[model samples]
Target: MTTTTATAEATTATDVLIVGAGPTGLTLACTLARAGAAVRIIDKSPEPHRASRGKGLNQRSRELFDDLGAGAEAAAWGTERVTLRKYRDGVAIADTVAFGDRTPTPDTPYASGLLIPQWRTEEVLRRTLARYGVEPEFGRELTGFTQGADGVVATLADGRRIKAAYLVGCDGGRSPVRKALDVTFEGRTDTEECMVIGDVRVDGLDPAYWHQWFDEDAAVMLCPFRGSTHWQLQGMPERDADGRALPPSLESFQRLVDRCSRRTDIRLSDPTWFSVYRINVRMADRFRTGRVLLAGDAAHVHSIAGGLGMNTGIQDAFNLGWKLAYVVRGLASPGLLDTYEEERLPVAAWTLGLTEERLRAVTEGVKQAGVGTEAVVTDDVTTLGVGYSWSSLAWGGAKAGERAPDGPCGDGRLFDVFAGPHFTLLGFGRGSAQALAEAGEKCADRLRTCLVDDPTGHARRAYGIGEGEDALVLVRPDNHIALSAGADRGAEIADRLLRLGR
Candidate 1:
């Protein structure tokens, strides 16, 4: 490949060139680096983001972080069991638990979400990425790119060129890569509906609950950031006489809070970050065009009603990481990369619809029933139940394409065995040991084989294997079951493995 810019100083090469250093891009970089892919990640911003943009991690995303070796650190900085305190006319009306009700089961270890700042989550990811000897190159912006049959050549703002086998756009909603591809972003932006959001320090306010005050026309919410004195503030944007929304400022935030809560004891100051948030429900027409792909907000965006924005992006990186790594490593054909969009596109569509519904519920519920935004919260928001059974890779029964459940195996849990940059094969009974051994010997570098010896039968039950029945399960690197079959079908198992790029 050749660059169009003659002034391009030098050409650097890598297996993958990722644009954007946000949570999604950082997660992808960590995954690819751990999988031994030569990755180069860059961001236009000179420094890491300091704002707490998306302030929560769902159960599914927590699992992804755990696999990346950053889960414990993220959890340490997060707060669980936070109470939602509602107020009306400065009087406390109701108090409800947000994520404290869920209990962890053997099959689902992370049943609850964590409340952590977005900047903190990015920090954890960056720390993990450093372990793999890769760091995002900040202030290196992608000015343009050209892709040929073999690879892509990206031109940066500094007149440098990066040649890579693949390019992924993890940039936010206004993605330059997506625009360069001429891809259509299909959906609408609700400019009329806007909110002023920021992180601020408050004095004389208790941090025990996520305080929310609601009146007939407006509302203000202050959620304390876990492990920090700062809190995230969200309220209606102040509008001028002509109905134009004013720019967000510390004074305007204070006025909104005082008017909504009717409280004089609270004081707000030291605004670290602030922005005007508008709902944009949109998704790219396609996730891929030749050697370039899109992930995270570059692919889809929705309302922040259910806090699914960042979690969905994290999950997107998890799903694409393994497939992209395999293709780069020559373990799979380029066609394997197509499955990334096939599997995740539907998920993005579902999330857009779900969040839009929740946004409507919050708006209408507040006016009709005096309900808070917490009314939008549901078990579905956890994303634990999301599956891709309809994908072409999913084969044989309901368990296929579903997330591999965690259960007790030997001394540790199933996740302990599944955590890594390799696929997993679980032989449920002695009858399947031979097949497991053969598959392991053939694909030793890319697959991990386990013979479950769970006396409590919890693992078998979670996997949908009947008591005393023999079965073989093949799980993808991302921990989704690719296929399952009877133990006796050893030849079929081998055939499927070979077809899956073993």
Candidate 2:
């Protein structure tokens, strides 16, 4: 209800105050702003850095951007990676493998992963956020926050305060917001987290290929970056001569690369970014608390096996954005915010498990044997397939547990009939037209009802309707099929949301 401008007053207000301007926070801010929510996003850093971290944008994430009109721009920054060749035992045996078949079906537009580095992804998000007329408040940190029945209030380091209907923590693992909430972060560090990561400017190297050497003791990964022949090299860190884990000296880094590939011919110049680190797999206790919530790295973090970090966080923002905006706009009940945790928490846990499995595969020598590189890319669970197991609109009209597959559809236009993160009704034939019309009247604001372009009337039968037969499909905001029924009888659809929220 109130906000303040005085730094000494320590009170300001927003519909939502998001902490951390990384992929997750920024995405949520963009969505909320577009939907007309008063949002404020802050980060501890003063500026966006060029350090590229997670570098892969999965198919689902790209589709998410397309809905917001930024997909094409985001897509342009990434290159498609068809295969990842891993040579075992220091020998270059298995080569490049073809892996493109597993993508979006005809109904969906994006199917493949775009291999753009994380820094560029942030740049694209920044550009899109500007269109919303809200730029992230960098260098602004959340000192702590407390919640009340009406809203939440967050404090900045200089003692400024912000009041908001809700507060979301998308900050990284060392999240100040999450820490203030005192939520438990569970899971072990996988003690054998033997991984060293850094970026380097490699001269004279083809900046198109990803080279992996799974040698005797160490595993090395080299990815060629765009705009420069410089590559991002990652490998297991070696202990110093005294057995202490030391930073990778220039000589050690070059030697590690040389030993893994069995080649000292390629020279290593000054490194751009250098760091030796351990990988830990962890997730939060819960994603919500009263008016405060957690997302992205603040909620969960895992091994970077398939480049799922940024993608997972970005999706978290997508899942929470519309919900927060709708509630903020008073268009929906406040219960919608609960769905953010129910839907995204499982996704985070699933991703953690998937990445752990992949980490094991590489660390434990679990190879496909006969399955080539193509299989690995799809089999790599870091690429997501998240669904709402607890939302009200759980039944897709066609079948139970069947996702809303993007298809040629009852519509004639190729990829034209797209359902977004909301409720939609597709009427096939005129059979169930009455039912659709009736249902459309009840929830005109919450659901979309349309007659399928069925000239032959097969759509009506397929939708469980007789001649002039019409059936209804209820889609969730995430574009997943929830339920399909006759228009008048579909009142029970609201009951599903009740159960999910309760």
Candidate 3:
């Protein structure tokens, strides 16, 4: 039997209960609300985090931000690339660009990586979510919870009880929610390596260039963060004069800069935020149990290499958000929720391998005079190539489970049509419009139809449609290809849509 606290300080109910206020939780909460599901998010932190951690977003993540209505804000808050300048013993060793030049195609408008502090990104998301009248409840920590066959009852630190249809753990690496689920976080923590990272104000450093100084036994890097006067400082200390570990304070940071840069010209002061980061590589053995699930760092934690940690978490929330919303709204079967783990877990495992390789390459290069240690922002890191062709829900299309490529349709773009909480069907050539209209009419509230005649074949080319063959492409609310079929398969696609909620 479900229990409720009567005459308690507060008792609430919601469709989804999110247990963190970070980017992952915030993104999921906002997505759920936009999809017309009731959501409540809570955080243990009393105030918004001020640290400038996880300061990069790949191309795919930028597209997601655009879809979430925070794209313009994110673009305005970040720069494309901040060049990295490396120095050894006060002499310039190499200067390299962090991102490569990848030109935008018709199907891919956002083709480059973005650099924005994680705090600012969260601020944008939170501000957007506020427009929906949903805000994170601060100082409310999840103490424990119990799940029955029907729903979950979440308990908070302050004696409030919440009955939610589903609960999610977007809490960080040391997630209390993950622990309550009894899931093992299997991975290695590098006790041998530690880096002190913080946002600091320094004198005599150009804000345009990310500067790194590497000496025989000491290393320090300072990168300018956009929209702020502070630079993010990262350093590894060899040992103090007494052969002890260095303290994580402004004075010690100054010592690191002086020792590594071999100059007193640059001075460090006024550290606003700081943390000692030990590299950890781990993933939860299971992402879901009963009515509870995990996303972001609570599900998987990656090394800082390739800057995949935050971006992956943000994407994870995006992937699960629409599915959760659909299931909660009774528009889709509960089995849809199972696909969240099926799709995201393998991606997390792939990211772990990629980041591990990058970390190894960088460390090996650093040991060998920093010659080959330049971090390359490749296509893989941009995550444009990520696809799920193997998913069981995918069907009949040449690009099933692939990212629904954006293209020109009528006077606007494909994404503009895919925007909002609705699946989209695009049909091309003769008889396509009627077929798509018939299918779309069946799910009028949840589906939108678009037609492209493409007399000159631009739209057809962008969508990879061939000559003499009309095409039907179905895009999920998250902008991934769900099914692709010949124009004749419209009835078949409609049948599939009708079965979605069964």
Candidate 4:
């Protein structure tokens, strides 16, 4: 049912084909390939560019990378910010708040945001892929595609073709693959303010703390970057008597900074790169069409209010990776695909609402002419708060338990189950070991089972796992619990895993 055109010279067939080589695409390719998938990634660009955008990686994204065996590289590239300070009209308002401590999560490791440019992140992921002997197929582009029940026939712009079982569109806002799927990206664009984003070396700004400056006229934000002396400055350019957009120039930017900071003597230099973009909160009505799907910007686009854009995309890949691997390995049913939208769609909507609320608060604060200090930047409302309610794969109700929370468990040392690639069974009483041992055998080729033993039992109370409880929990490989049947229902856990995809 699939055919390759003469142009796809790299291979006759690929298990998974990904369009676009941005962070989201590359991350999905990496996840799929690492699990023994034959993944091929193509981008129109011949090489990666030097433009530095999205200066901060939220807590959820950092944790995902750590799980994929690249945490050290991420740490080497980013500096941690311990304190967050708020400013008002060139004067101090509320003191700095300590919000940088990493916390426990259901599946991931990183608990705080790390300062790093978008390019640096791609570099690490590229290297990680190279280690596995899979180089990205750059300079190639997808022109058209036809889908069938078995696979898809994708044509290349240069007359080449490839047959793939599945395809993920990680391309940016203007995604060709998403267009081919005929999905509607529903949302509106806000032109009130276009952000001028850039990274540079500043002569005298402390990197340990994040600083914000707010004034009646304009605002200035300076945050720490991975490299020494380099800082990301997002400045609102000054306008004339007319309300026309100001041409963002060096002197104009400096004057705005000086007027807000009251530091006219401070000199600035070395402009790396700058761009103006109006943030649009948009998304596809459906995440997947047949075997072709979307993630990251291809699926959702929103403001930088929570620094959660890229992080949400990365987590989306994480959420899909394990499921795809299991289904590809013939261990789960195809029914798993529906859960992707049911779980992630609502999360994206919540994030859009939260970011809009944050933007509104900042706009109101600007009208009042005070620094929008309390409007904390985050994309977590979309990234971390994601949970599945309508998933046929997940057991629903209080019997469904509290959608599984992340906290300190086991012996004294804190641990998260996802430190390894496996499904975890959390129990408060006896009979859990037996339940998992049985599920492990039934889905031995698909799910790896682990029992999180917490003698202290605080974890049980926190997750509503009652003491002397007689229930057996079934967590997916991605760390989301699929079922929480009582101890008498251990056999049902394995049954659910086997019958889930059908």
Candidate 5:
């Protein structure tokens, strides 16, 4: 795909202007660029973040990265299925395997989450974005913005101006774009609960396990990052006399480790990053206002118990990228963009509730039996079960609005056909030839049709189609099933695509 960036004197024009070049913004930029949309991504930070913030990726996020062409590099730099080792009073207690007894299947290839530092994940995304001839403009910050009927005009901190058909905030929780829109972030912050988190180099510890030490009053976890010497530390913070958490430092972290493990032999030094983490569960009332929109942390933030923060944001970008591209290219009506919020907002709500429950369970389990951090790991956190069944675009079958399952397709797999920025029409069995031909006739430019050869019956079983039956399944660019129907409904499928474009 070919893309172009426009600039006129002091003002820059783009199809989408993304603020905050973190994983969310970078992912969005990459997605749009791949779809031939002119995009510009800017961040206030002078450079990429060095700290390991969100330290893992769920299975769904792994799939998104795979689709973006960064999966191989990420897997090379990441460690999967690290064992969780628990300790009590400096003595070993229990050892639990991550994603116990789960392995990759035909329909779901990514069976386990990956342990890679947040910085590494961002690095992978940045590299992918660079492949599209786009690089993030660091130190460029959005000061304010105003939207008109056609586009948004954004002012920067440096007095530069940007005009874009759409502006998305992939910014952090304290997003200026969302605030300028005056959207309410409805949730509570837990001031009483806090944890000190950072990346540090530690000696006298095995790099094999995610080490966790638990006691009655406090707990600490040190997870060794893959392909690095640094370990991400999370522990109960020391409080002052007024019951306020003190500032985090190297010495404070050492004390925390010693007190939590009841061991003085473990040595810690060279702290690269440190901060106090508070429980803040908040979601923006509206993900979009006029031409401005929000994704990632700007849209919703919840507990990090399930490591859903970064993954959710990456998925949000994937969901919005194709819709934005379609509208900008005039191939789809502007109303198509409304479905982004419609589909993602409910997922955000579900994520908040699920993570909150997990956090509460971990807290109570720690008090009862000194449960390890592995207690938080469940199949739900993998995010493979998450779907948009309630979405307006979902229709005709049980699989609609759900993720398109991967399966055998002749020499390769189903994902190989869904790898690009185009919709896929899967015609199951010979009877679907008419439906495939009709859909191809109407949406040939934006759609790819495949007559699935299911000799092993894996594809049929995964998609809920009978062995000898035929069906037509339309999959969105983001790999979500849009609609499913019998093979005879060829014209109906074509009509749906035409209506969407209109």
Candidate 6:
């Protein structure tokens, strides 16, 4: 790893400076770079992390990835609907399918979850980011920085200085940016509980199912990864008699398997990465401070029980990316950036509560036959139901701040039209032509107008517009409804956008 920073001048610059190259930072960097913005991403680690901690991609995150052009790559490398087989005291007690298959509807294109290692997810995102000619700089650590009214000047550990209009901390839980800003990360850590998670190869373990062995006190699980020899292992440790925690190692893991599964014949080998993670449930009091902000684990951390940690961070990056792009491009108001925190903070809090509830539900009850783990893996956890209905940007329509659904358009899906770095105005029927024309004239550079004149009424029903009742729905670049109204509110729509920039 090269530690020497470029010494061109004291005022090195970019449009956005991102600290950390994990899933969150990579997604934000990709989004900004794809929008023709200059972005620089740096990570302290010498190379990419190879842990398989987070393995599930929910429906909403999948759609976001699909929009970002990384979803297909992810789907190509991921597995679908692996069943969970539960055991107790060496006997196969129950069989449950945690991720069942589901068909896509006109409104929802991705109805099923995909399981892949988090490191692989980052690989696909990094590949997409490379298409924009932006690669993450490793071995560059953020030592300190200062932000002002105009821009931010960040100092790296290698004695480099970077000047950028915006600085984001996608760094993990111990975020330097958040700490420097003194933003309160409110939460508690379960010192009594720790899980040994790792990726390893095991003999005598079937690759077809997610093997789980659980009892009243301890559990060990091995989940198979697609197209790979490694399986993700999760095991609760048996504390010593003095109440001291045991260190994580292959030997300890073998003991866990022996004690929980009674499988002395199974041999574990090629242990790649492992950690005894102390469960932390935390969220920053706020997500922004001036031009510097936080996304992903920098802003929030949750228990891994529901697999929402990485997915929520990805969603955070998606929500913040376009808003930051618009403001940086001078197409929108600075206050537009404020909506990132406003819209996502509630969702983060709700996720914390939901995950805590699900964690308790799944761990406290009897290890029953056919006990549904569906609550943790269903559409709710997929974040398909997440919306910004209460945000200030939402007005006039019943589904404002909600996700703009996909429908049949021309020869492709409606999402195909909403694929790039531009907002879309969907006008239903001939009555909306005037509104579309006026809005198009006002925001011609950043907005695209699409008129759906289908006789089958699929598009109308997709957005819940009644027959012959014209409506106008404006979708943001992140595929959320920004404004919705009748055909006559063209002036109001234009005025709202202008006010948002103010």
lDDT for model 5: 0.88
Report the lDDT tens digits of candidate 2 across residue range 181-238: 7789988775444566667766544455677776555667777656544566777777
Candidate 3 lDDT, tens digit per residue, 191-296? Answer: 7678889989889988888888766677889988787888899998546686655658888788788888888899877889978888899999999987899999
What lDDT is reached at residue 309 by model 1? 91
- Backbone collision count in every prediction? 0, 22, 0, 12, 0, 1
Instruction: Give the TM-score comparing model 3 with the true structure, all chains together.
Output: 0.94
Local distance difference test, per candidate?
0.88, 0.69, 0.84, 0.69, 0.88, 0.85
Kindly list the per-residue Cα lDDT of model 5 for residues 1-502, writing each as its tens digit.
Answer: 1112323332337999999988899889999999999999999999898899998888999998999999999999998888888888777888888886898999999989889998998999999999999999999988877677767778888898888999999999998888888889999999898999999999988999889988877788999987788899999888899988998888988998988777777899888999999999999998998888999999999999989999999999999999999889877899989999999999999999999999987877766553677668888898898888988888668599999999999999999899989999999989899779878988887889999988999998999888798888888999999888899887887777777845
Specify the poorest-scoring 10-residue window by lDDT in model 2: 1-10
In terms of TM-score, which candidate is stronger, 1 or 3?
Answer: 1
lDDT tens per residue, model 6, 369-458: 445344466557878879999888786585789888888887787888898888889888788999999988998878888887566777
* Model 3, residue pairs in steric clash: none
Clashes of 2: 22
Could you tell me the lDDT of residue 241 within candidate 5?
95
Pairs in steric clash, model 6: 333-501
RMSD (Å) per prediction: 2.4, 4.4, 2.9, 3.8, 3.6, 3.2
C-alpha lDDT of candidate 6 relative to the true structure: 0.85
TM-score of model number 6: 0.95
TM-score of 4: 0.87
lDDT of 4 at 352: 77
Better lDDT candidate (3, 5): 5
lDDT of 4 by residue, 297-388 (tens): 89999887766778777877877877676666666677777677777777778777877887776677655433453455453442444666
Cα lDDT over the full model 3: 0.84
